[model samples]
Target: MESMLIEKSIQGDVASFEQLIVKYNRYVYNIAFRMMGNEEDAKDMSQEALIKAFKAIGQFKREANFSTWLYRITINVCKDEMRKRKEHVLSYDVENQDEGSMKENIKDESTNPILIYEQLELKETIETALNKLSEDSKAVVVLKDLLGYSYEEIGTILDIPVGTVRSRLNRSRSALKSILQVQLAEQ
Candidate 1:
């Protein structure tokens, strides 16, 4: 089914391309939001990625799943935007704003609101720590840890070696621990 969409899209069928965008827009936006750390930038990056994908659809070799291809494009769009901004773009406040939804799974009435607050604080701190990482390290952390991609898949998505992905993940994790430890000490 995806292959059909890709084929039709590559053949310059605007409707087919639009359908592909509709299918993947949210997925792309999510990745963008995580990478950019804000909704507005994520939306912008998602649209840019879709435009790039539409233009470059003919060059897609069918060697990867369409979603994977979209991911690569989205990642590149994020990295490019990051380069242009030359600053940390993640907005920890977004997480705080979504707390109501995040707490929906905590059905236990006995759960402490104070504990939840602490957890949210910790989560925001960790997100801030993530922003401290270099873009490459951040990307590895997002893909491997946040998005649950395997080391090999992360390497494929980022066009790096598996060893590189492992090293980046390790370094990023170590950095995160150090940052969190410092934050905890300050509290």
Candidate 2:
């Protein structure tokens, strides 16, 4: 069914493309949000990536994984925007997130106001640290840690070797630990 949609999409069928969008929109938006670190930019980048995907559907090989192809496009779009801005100080707009989004990850602790506060604080700190990372390192961390993609999968998405992925993830993790330690100590 997905292959059919892809074929039709490649043939310039807007409805078929919309069907594919419906299936992958959340995934694309989630990656965009993580990379952009804000809702507004995420939405904009996600839309831009989807538009690019629609335009390049013919170049998509049938043997390749659709999600991976889409992810590469999304990441490239976000990275291009990041490059243009040349600003790493991203603000994670937690208050603006929908109830069903990343906010849901901390919902289990909501019953305890203290835990909720602590969770939010930690989340913000982590997001801040993540935003400080280089685009390459952050992409590795977001894909492997936050998005739960395997090492091989991340390499495929980022067009890097598995060893490179492992090394970047290691360095990114160390950097995040150091940043978190300093942040926690300051509080």
Top lDDT: which candidate number? 2
The residue-by-residue lDDT of candidate 1 on 1-187, one tens digit each, is 7789889999999898998778678878888877777788889999899989999999988887777788899999998988887753543332223434334433343544334457778888877667755667778888888889899888888988999899878877765555555455455
Residues 1-187 of candidate 2 have per-residue lDDT tens digits of 9999999999999999999889789989989988888899999999999999999999998888999999999999999999899754443322222324333443443353333347779888888778766677788889988989999999889999999999889977766655554455556
Q: Give the TM-score of candidate 2.
A: 0.82
- Point out the worst 10-residue segment of candidate 1 by lDDT: 90-99
Name the lDDT of candidate 2.
Answer: 0.81
Candidate 2 segments whose C-alpha is farther than 4 A from its true place: 87-117
lDDT per model vs. reference = 0.75, 0.81
User: What is every candidate's alpha-carbon RMSD to the true fold?
Assistant: 9.0, 9.3
